[model samples]
Target: MRADRLISILMMLQMEGRMTAAELARRLEVSERTIYRDMDALSISGVPVYADPGVGGGFVLPANYKMTIGGLTTAEIQAVFMHLAGGSFEQLGIGPPLRSALLKLLHALPDQSRRDAEWIQQRIYLDPESWSQDEKTAPYLQAAQQAIWEQHAVTMTYTSREGHELCLKLKPYGLVAKAGVWFLVGETEGNVRAFRLLRIDSLEGKQEERFVRPEDFDLQVFWQEWLEKYESR
Candidate 1:
């Protein structure tokens, strides 16, 4: 994720104007030495960054050099940030990187577009969790996310409705978040099913075993049918 970190540093400098090495190290959870190396990498890549020496000095990106997203209108910028308000990004352990990327986009937006996006962000609030339920945890969500994205199988022990611990090797096709809960939708036993990640006692990706996702599978259609059956039962 060095690339991501590098981009984050760039965006951070663009937004903050100046940041000390120690501050960047603490925020990024890396050593100060790593920050120095990253700065070198950035400079070598021709990014216009420099260190300010003396009292109250820090890494600086010039104020006059601005990056702007020219094609996107103010309305489009609003739409992007509005979709980002839901809490699902944090559920899958993607909150930090996702937010960082959003910041990058927000910084690149034109002055008026950025103002509108910030206005909507301040006014609107979204809570995806259900009022009737407590928060659910899915410790294996990161693993499931990796497996699904790489088209690999996952080995896990799933707690069945009958309270039996069943071993499974699942080829994850997609993951669905419903009512603030995460579900792993995958192929097992020659059938597609959804497994609640909380019920998974243990999970690991089978990196050596990859599978082709069914080309005809429609995740939305399947989820609708699955929901109907669950409700009827």
Candidate 2:
């Protein structure tokens, strides 16, 4: 645990440039004396960490200093890849980036750890799709995802379950994938709604007409509340 705490402290200083001993201690949930000892340990261990005395002084790393992904344990490396393998990132049209990142992580590992990680990948598997169900495809899923990421309004031609067609302008909030189905959650006419991705006949993102998202809007909370209300009815 001390090793982890020391690493975390280094990371904090790396990102923050400079931090007081009190600040570092508070962030690490340790005492100021412990922080001082940790700084001494880092300096002795060949890490370029130094403290400045007096006001506005704390630990500071060189401006150009950067930490590599090297210090990860073998088990940590395996866990990272395993979690990545469990996600449906590919279906969300981010397969290329995900694969690129995995390759980078793999390449960063030492030879022995790389082989161990590969072994773990070969032994454990993750299939995000549900069993014995027809594969669901949403033609507009990627567009909706992009719209949400860019905070843009989109004009969508949607058909309700009752077989009525409606064309509406929506301020895309987020996208949710459930049971192999994708849903687009957004705002239209001051009301938040969720539309089935499959039901969207056409989608055109209006990038020039962006809407400000509410500061308190949270995708997970919104999705949960919507699911609760839908299920209750």
Candidate 3:
């Protein structure tokens, strides 16, 4: 447990540049004194960790220092690469970038870990589409993703299940991809609703208006509750 905590501390400092002992303790769920001891251990072990005392002072590494993936075990490498094989990035329009990142991670691994990851990738297949069904991304998916990311309200020309065409102003809270289909979860006229991406005939002026996301909203929890309610019916 201490070993993992030490690695996490090193990673936090490396990524954040500088952090106070109190901040590290709060993030790591430990006491401030423990953070001081851990910092000492890192410095003594040739990690080049340093601390500055006083207000606005904290722990930092030299800007030129770089951390490597040498600490990862074989199982850890396999787990990471296996997740990459699951194939959700393609629907998000980032398949090429995801492949590039996988190659970089493979190159960074040790020889045996690289081999294990490759072997796992070959054996584990994630086919999200159903057999005999032609699955394709929704036409307005990219637009909805952009609107959700930028916190913009979109005017959508949508086709309802009963074949009615309606215009809606949507404050997009999040986008969910399930089993190769995408849904936009958001609010329409003060009522929370989910819009199937495929039902949108067109989207207009995604960035023309912006809205703040509610602080109390959580996508995963909301989805789970929705699933429970749907299943109970």
Q: List RMSD in Å for every model shown.
A: 14.5, 5.4, 4.1
User: lDDT of each model, Cα atoms only?
Assistant: 0.86, 0.85, 0.83
Q: Write the per-residue lDDT of candidate 2 for residues 1-233, one digit (tens) a residue.
A: 88988899888988888999888987788999999998888889988988778888888988877888678887787778877884458878788899998988888887888888888888988777766444456788788888888898999999998999999999999888775677899999999999988788899989999878897888898999999998897
Candidate 2 global CA lDDT score? 0.85
Screening candidate 2 with a backbone cut-off below 3 angstroms (N, C-alpha, C), the clashing residue pairs are: none
TM-score of each: 0.62, 0.67, 0.73
| Models ranked on lDDT | 1, 2, 3
Pairs of residues at least 3 apart in sequence or in different chains that clash in candidate 3: none
lDDT tens per residue, model 1, 72-106: 66667777887887788888778899999999988
Candidates 2 and 3: which is better by TM-score? 3
Which clashing pairs does model 1 show?
A: none
Residues 73-181 of candidate 3: C-alpha lDDT, one tens digit per residue: 7677777876666545777789899999989988988898788888888887777655634457577777788888899998988898789998999898988776777
What order do you get sorting by TM-score, best first? 3, 2, 1
